[model samples]
Target: MSSETKSPTPSAGLKSNLPSTTTFITGHNAEGKAIVLDSRPATWKSFENGVMGFNQIYTNPFPPDLNGDADLHFHDDKIASGNLGLAVKNGTVCRMVDFGPGYVCMMHRTQSLDFGIVVEGKIDLVLDDGSSTHMKRGDIAVQRATMHSWRNPSTTDWARMLFVLQDARPLFVDGVRFGEDYGRGTEGLPRSGNDD
Candidate 1:
């Protein structure tokens, strides 16, 4: 990653008001005993004019190969390359997102099954049909290739969400395939599965 894009410690980000996130990665030692491979605050990337930020926790190709800790190497490569997009083809990505106060994300969709959990504050999940649902801490939203947007209703506090996105077959609704849609919110970022 370029120095400009490299993330500083969690306390140095645009969303400093939000609490930092610590990630724990486990692996097996040479003796085959489980060990703590890594435990530290996650790296974050602030975007959308600093109104939104993403902390990429981990990623691995589907049917991950853990032997020799190859998956860990893969994740390190992704970070070093600084091309971890919204989704990985035939893989899974665990990320944490911070929404600035009163921020509303653009409507978009990805070809993945996402499990989004509200970790702090409240948010509204708005669907393409104009329907929405209010969610608070501890609430989880199971998104199956749906066109949606997220809105943080708070005007003074930031909201945090942890999402696990797993690649899925392209959604076919009425014979129409809905591929990855970055929409307006994601401009510089590549589309899903295009990190390379």
Candidate 2:
């Protein structure tokens, strides 16, 4: 038996992994009846020669209903995840990311805490402190509003990760608040696309 994991290839015109089948479940009426609100294949957005794939799962509005056992919210599909915009105040965003071989994202920061899990292949989590760690399938990463990047060094493999981001206080340094900096410290890297 071979120990190599299979690398993903794009499906026809799709420049990313096979679309994810997402089913959104929610509660209905005052009785909290469970129901499937929507179920569809996730639409992928490609970046940097199809080296990266982005598919948003959902976005919760501000002040998530704490009083209700079942929360009814709307997701705005028009906004792209690459826009570097945070979710609504006290809100959260869920997404899936795919990294192709030789893929490396710019070192950037977001104003939200992120929980990520690797679903396939392996990747390197590069941090702003000149450090990195290799992550493989089933590994979970809890990023607390830190400056970081994703690197896929393999030349014949791809990596996929799912992330949940929640709004958080900006990183404060010496009494200065440093919020999301998408292109910060990304010199010498591809500027257009491949950012999240």
Could you say which candidate leads in lDDT? 1
lDDT of 1 at 26: 78
Tens-place lDDT digits, model 2, residues 64-86: 65344323334543243334343
TM-score computed on alpha carbons, candidate 2: 0.74
Model 1 CA RMSD to the hidden true structure, in angstroms: 4.2
User: TM-scores, in order shown?
Assistant: 0.90, 0.74
Which pairs, if any, clash in model 1? none
- Candidate 2 steric clashes: 0
Residue pairs whose backbone atoms clash in candidate 2: none
TM-score of structure candidate 1: 0.90
